[model samples]
Target: DAGVTQSPTHLIKTRGQQVTLRCSPKSGHDTVSWYQQALGQGPQFIFQYYEEEERQRGNFPDRFSGHQFPNYSSELNVNALLLGDSALYLCASSLGLAGDSYNEQFFGPGTRLTVL
Candidate 1:
């Protein structure tokens, strides 16, 4: 049984460029959530996907978008990226939307994105 997973463990890009991050949920999980962790700060919620629909989002801007497939995997997209956008993009897998049933969370190591 694999836990959450992320791709392109590391990435480098110039400001104003676009980037896409990928994630696959854990087995038996149907919900996927994304977060951004700055150098020394805690993770900031980006958005969440459930049943192929976006059910929740954080304080991120419109440039940040996401998608969830029927298989429960997800992708995060950042357009017109900024230097500040550089960070560890994390993916978390849960049983369902918050407060649904399961509370335990599974996490991925995260994708490191650097915007120069």
Candidate 2:
């Protein structure tokens, strides 16, 4: 089966622009997590979704939003983008909620967003 996958591999937007990135989870996975990775830094958790509801969120501001579809696909939407928003957006798939100890995450190749 195919692992997690992200769309538009790369994107460019001006500051204040809005962008949406998509992800499709691996087979049989029901949860999805989004992360942002800046240059030279490890991925930072953005939010997580399970059963089509956002279950957890990290330190990101309100400008960052997301949704999970019934088919286990997800979309990460960022509004009023800023230069600081430029980063590699990652999507990871797992079998259960973040609280589940047995859940192992499989990450996608990531969508690279550049803000000018």
Candidate 3:
């Protein structure tokens, strides 16, 4: 089975522009988490979704939002983009809730977003 996949491997946007990145989870996975990775920095958690609801969120501002569908696909939407928003946006899929220690997350190749 295919692992997690993200659309538009790369994206370019200007400040104040909006972008939406898509992700399809691995087979049988039900939860999806989004992260942002800056140059030379580890991925920073953005938010997590399970059962079609956002279960947790990191330090990102309100400009970042997301949604999970019944089929386990997800979309990360960023509004009023800024230069600081330029980063590799990652999508990870797991089998259970965020608190489940036994659940391992499989990450996608990531969508690289560049803000000018």
Model 3 spans > 4 angstroms off: 98-100
The window of 10 residues in a row where model 3 has the poorest summed lDDT is: 96-105
Residue-level lDDT tens digits of model 1 in 1-116:
99899998999999999999999999999989999999999999999899899898899999999999889899999999999999999999989755656577789999999999
RMSD of each: 1.4, 1.3, 1.3
List residue ranges in candidate 1 displaced over 4 A. Answer: 98-102
Please give the lDDT score at residue 13 for candidate 1.
Answer: 95
In terms of lDDT, model 2 sits at 0.96
RMSD of 1: 1.4
lDDT of each: 0.93, 0.96, 0.96
lDDT of 2 by residue, 11-67 (tens): 999999999999999999999999999999999999999999999999999999999
Q: Write the per-residue lDDT of candidate 3 for residues 1-116, one digit (tens) a residue.
A: 99999998999999999999999999999999999999999999999999999999999999999999999899999999999999999999999864747788999999999999
**Candidate 1 residue pairs in clash (backbone atoms < 3 Å):** none
